[model samples]
Target: MAKRSLPILSDGAAKKILRDLCKQHNVSLELVTQMIEIQRENLGRGRQIGITQDFSAAIAEFLDSASIVRGE
Candidate 1:
């Protein structure tokens, strides 16, 4: 059998996923927005590229840490 591949999400789709996750988890949208801004700043003055995975990873990590902190 051939290995299955995941489809790449568009930027808007990825943002929506992050936003929804925040809402579902009771995480503040403001914090998520700040996290996104921090990621963009970290990318610096180069052409922005491959942001989908980075954004998703940031949200996932933030959620993980938040849960750990809250002992959820």
Candidate 2:
């Protein structure tokens, strides 16, 4: 069987979908906004670490941060 691929959405399209889903489900848009901010920060950090060629450090940092956020 051939592998299937999902369609990539632009930022506006993705945000609109998320906003609609959130509204339908009575979810808070602020929560969605925070999630996006966290992801963007992680991406920026990863890009910075990539320039330094420290993927292991990046993985460790991400794991540590995630654990802290989850109160693990």
Candidate 3:
């Protein structure tokens, strides 16, 4: 199977997603970078990006968790 290009996310949105994920997972930016690399590598082997369904949901979930953590 061949891989396809992923939908391009806005830089701001992507940065926010990464930040929220790091916070939610109690991980550092370095770990987030690693996780993202892992995610990309896993998907690319099968010609995909992140799980289409899971990616947005995961980001949303992370943001929700971050907001709660911040007492928002």
Compare the candidates by lDDT and give the number of the best one. 1
Q: What C-alpha lDDT, on a 0 to 100 scale, does residue 26 get in candidate 3? A: 80
lDDT of 2 by residue, 21-51 (tens): 8799765555555544444445536354443
After superposing candidate 3, which stretches have Cα over 4 Å from the reference? Answer: 1-50
RMSD of 3: 9.6
How does each model score on lDDT? 0.66, 0.56, 0.60
Point out where model 1 deviates above 4 Å.
1-47
What is the number of backbone collisions in each predicted candidate, taken in the order shown?
A: 0, 0, 1
Q: Is candidate 2 or candidate 3 better by lDDT?
A: 3
Candidate 3: global Cα-lDDT?
0.60
TM-score, prediction 1: 0.37
Judge candidate 2 against the unseen true structure and give its global Cα lDDT, from 0 to 1: 0.56
Model 2 spans > 4 angstroms off: 1-16, 44-72
Identify the leading candidate in terms of TM-score: 1
Models ranked on lDDT: 1, 3, 2
Could you tell me how far off, in angstroms, the CA of residue 39 lies in candidate 3 after the best superposition?
A: 2.5
Per-residue lDDT for 16 in model 1? 78
